[model samples]
Target chain A: MQRSPDDLTLSGDEQIAGEADRPFARSLPWLLLVGGLVGFAAAFTLTVEKIALLRDPDYVPTCSINPILSCGSVMRTPQAEVFGFPNPLIGVAAFAALAAIGAAMLAGARPRPWFWAGLQAGVTFGVVFVHWLIWQSLYVIGALCPYCMVVWVVTILLFWYVTLVNLGRTRAGRLLAEYHAVALTAWFLLIIGLITVRFWDYWSSLI
Target chain B: MAFKSPQNTTASGARAKIDAARAQDRRRAARKRNMTIVASLVAAFAVIVAVFLAVDPGSGPDGDTLAAGESRYVRSDSHRLTTAADGKVTLVEFLDFECEACRGMYPLVESLRKEYEGRVTFVVRYFPLPGHFNAERAARAVEAAAQQDKFEIMYQRMYQTQTEWGEKRTPADEYFRGLAQGLGMDMAAWQKAYEDPATLARVKKDVADGQALGVQGTPTFYLNGTLVQVQMQDDLKKAIDAALAG
Candidate 1:
């Protein structure tokens, strides 16, 4: 009655009940792989732009399309370097690690429960930090960076899935997981709707 | 070793049945939970839609209403930097050309114009302060430019070259005329318009209107006839956006 090394069932009771039958158990690896890679690329691009701006003070970022959607404005803000270093550096490291972990999981690495808990902690922190950044971009900074937005999307998706997977043992969590697609769509709609409404004037000018 | 004892085999079969029953019960529970979540989501969405339709913001009390007869926000003769097609949202800035703060705000306003281009109606009004020696002269110069369809050009030029002629005790009338020359305006017409008493009166009219509206400083902005207290550069843009949203 011994489980194999990679079985991620949280407890023996759930394992006995075959908790690994969930679809997320199979799909999450791929999600992490793709989400992590996309986030990594965005963060990497932002880091490059920040470095270029530092090298030449007059550098206009490629994402500086207009005043409202200007990366140049967002990058120049103190919040861009909240930890006394560029925030994208954290993104670069964290996303790369997530991608590596996803690759390992795809290769049948059933990490210890401690590892999953640690990852949950990391993603929770990422989600909170990203939301703070979103607020800063929308209200305080009054600008949006395209690459930063990409990171925001990936981070939110990753956080939701990871939390669902970790809380799989709970009945409410399982219920939420069943409606993940609906929940994700609603979540994204809320954010995108806010963006559209907040900058309606600037957006309408394009039309 | 194929040592299948009869009693042991029966116990394993019964355990298998129990496990299957537990799984089926779990799935039934999950299905009920799913239904509950979906039903609640639908109910929440319906409530949201109902609340949205119920709240008629136009009929609500507007805190930023202008007093009666304070139509000085935009006159027919007011110069527009950009006009919206719907004419729904108008942003008026009472600016003094020679004021240092107005010069500092120049780029921010220009960027806002670009961002809100056709979605906002941007109007300019002269509120030349008495402190600066060249304030009145600059307003008169710009007003004169308006006569020749060069109001926008002169308006831009004044801010672009504010440092050169601003804060000077002597008359920068010559400097403003130089800007007019740079713009290739007809010198005779420019001189006449610049010196016209009527042009000065036009500038004074705006100043008087701004005073009546409580515009005590340069770079005062009004979004849809309500004065905007802009403590930050983005406040002007934010106010216009809120008006447009409304």
Candidate 2:
């Protein structure tokens, strides 16, 4: 590892090049592969279920477990097809690409600057879109879709990791990398708290 | 082997001392970095949670009010559970008779209408979803009953016996006709009106009006012309009480 002379810290010990290829760092590619695959499968299933719903007006989706968690209720609304087509079409394409990229990373492909930038952009859009959906689900349309929630979780993790990788050698990014799990744990807790509080009545009844 | 010579041993000893010093330095740097990162991350997490809580929809009193058009929602011929001549608050409900959710809210609304009998004018507008088999015909039955001045009676009976006839996925016209006779309605007149375009038109008009008002589901409530976010009974009661107070 090469150290920059001007980048010396207060302790004056070499902080090194912060090269991300440490032996333990190899596990990140594997995590991405698994997360991407699960997300792709979920998005694909939601799209297929959407087609089934279109074919039959009375079709109750597999994800329609209850009133609170029904894809059927969500699908009938305009928000489900915001772009004049089902939103899952975008998901199916995006997640499939995400899974393919994850597989390439697992195969030891060191992506270039443009590749990392592309991943960052894709995930940034996904995070924003999912946040909007979370707001809509809790406030506007007033329902939750199970497959959509799966996509939301995976997308969040994917975005977080992608961002960490894109930050390169910055001090902030290095700090983030060292405590990646801590950041992820906080994010998960925040979202879970939001959902629990939003549907407190229904959730409390289950117990 | 090189250290076997005295000259090389001196060099090797100096190198060993330097390597030990570097190792100690690296360990200290690692400790410092790890601690700083953890502290920074915890602080970042706390700040994020605080900011989110400040703007969270869960904590905000952001009401989901519908922009109902300029027209007053209630038609002169619309169904009324309680008709108060000078009632200040009008609770408009867009409902489907066969919807299970409507059935669930039936007793609740019924009790409220009775409790606030003279204070509120409770109106029901037809909004029969295509999926429900008996919803449209039930609307017609209610309309047919309305012709004989027994709208309230038939409304109660239909809801009271909803489970017996609802969600059958088959026509329940004959059963509804039986209900009309039981309600002491003019059976012949009710039968003619059942097939009359005017009665069907009456029901369809209410549905069209509901659609115009942006009603997309059963049991959608418009209290005093604003959509009330029905999270709890207290929330709804508060809206009604506000409307009545005004």
Candidate 3:
């Protein structure tokens, strides 16, 4: 029943193919956990800043400068508190859930199928809000809130990581394995470059 | 006849093994279905997020109508006209004549005035910031234009040609006269009002009113008494609706 060395070589080739096919099978959990944790921290920080602003009118944080770099200028505007409530309340709730998911993942708990679906949904929401806030800051408000920019940058990175992790989990990994890492890194760099260009004026004006 | 036996046996064996191919097809179909479902879910979630962010949510009353005990205008000086028109919403704009942002906001105010004619009352108040050299003189010129019933025309002209008169190189009076001539105003009357000390006092009063209301910059607005911090059309409409409702 002993196979020849040529037969053994063929079997080894098949094993390697199988391993290559499931490339991200081991790393999916870790990716989601870390991405979610970073996302949650960024969102939580923004929520705290927004709450402090809401609690006190005269309490202008150090961010509010002249017409262009003012946090109060944009926050006092209608765009900041869409839905008649400060939009940061949504951030607080959603990011808290993300952080809990991250904790569960770190504790070696396998998320149910529904959890993956919901994470995808939440990340999509976060990405859309980030883009909208950027538009408001660039075009409408004509000002940039420095803390808000931090939230935006972190949201983009987390969204990209979550998307890659989700693709790696499902059967789609077979298709996405070709350039996942390269594409994700490229996207991250592009986003950072864009945000830098958008705030170029503020950067130049700094003393 | 001897060759037929082996060929027929092989053909029958292949027919018997066709079940495995059918099973493989079933597995492929299941995987396809799962992929489709996941793709649809992701797409649906994206659409929902886009819609939520796109919705404007309307404006709510979050701040005071005006900071406590603040006067609408600094003083009832010669230049200040207090007109009362019942049941119409009023829009009061405090603008610096030489400010770039104020210049940008000029046409929007004009368009709103025209669009909501008779339903809205529009008032212009001058708040020339001290930093800009020509802003005070330009405010005086605009006040003179008001005396000639050419306030709107000259206001538009100021923004339209802001760089020429406001920035440098030309005196304020000369620039105002050129703008007046361009707008077909009577030159003599325009000059008389431009030189009047009373007009300067009025411009100063406008600045005081703006400062009293915590107006830190040019192009500040008051819609029926609430200080409007943002200039979005939809938000402005919502604030107007609330004012009407009250």
Instruction: Please name the candidate that would achieve the greatest lDDT relative to the true structure.
Output: 1
Q: How much lDDT does each candidate structure score?
A: 0.80, 0.74, 0.63
lDDT of 1 at A59: 74
- Model 3 misplaced regions, further than 4 Å: A1-42, A65-68, A169-182, A185-202, A205-207, B1-246
- What would the per-residue lDDT of candidate 3 be over residues A1-207, giving only the tens digit for each residue? 322111122234453433222335345456546655665665566567677876865455567664345676667778988788877667667656666776676676665546667888888988998888888777666667766776676677667656765564244643444445445555555554554455443333231
Model 2 lDDT tens row, B1-246: 111234577776786677667756864776676677667767776676566545542321111221233243776566778876685688989888888888888888887888888888898888889899889889889888888888888888888889999989767878999999888888999987775544655676677677777888988999877887777767767888888887
Docking class of 3: incorrect
- For A117-198, candidate 2 gives per-residue lDDT tens digits of 7888999999999998888887776668999999899989888877876664467766776666667766776777777677
Per-residue lDDT, model 3, residue A90, is 73
Candidate 1, DockQ to 2 decimals? 0.17
Question: If both were scored by DockQ, which would come out higher, candidate 2 or candidate 3?
Answer: 2
Better of 2 and 3 by lDDT: 2
Per-model chain B TM-scores are: 0.71, 0.69, 0.62
lDDT of 2: 0.74
Better of 2 and 3 by TM-score: 2
What CA RMSD would candidate 3 show?
A: 20.9
Clashing pairs in 1: none
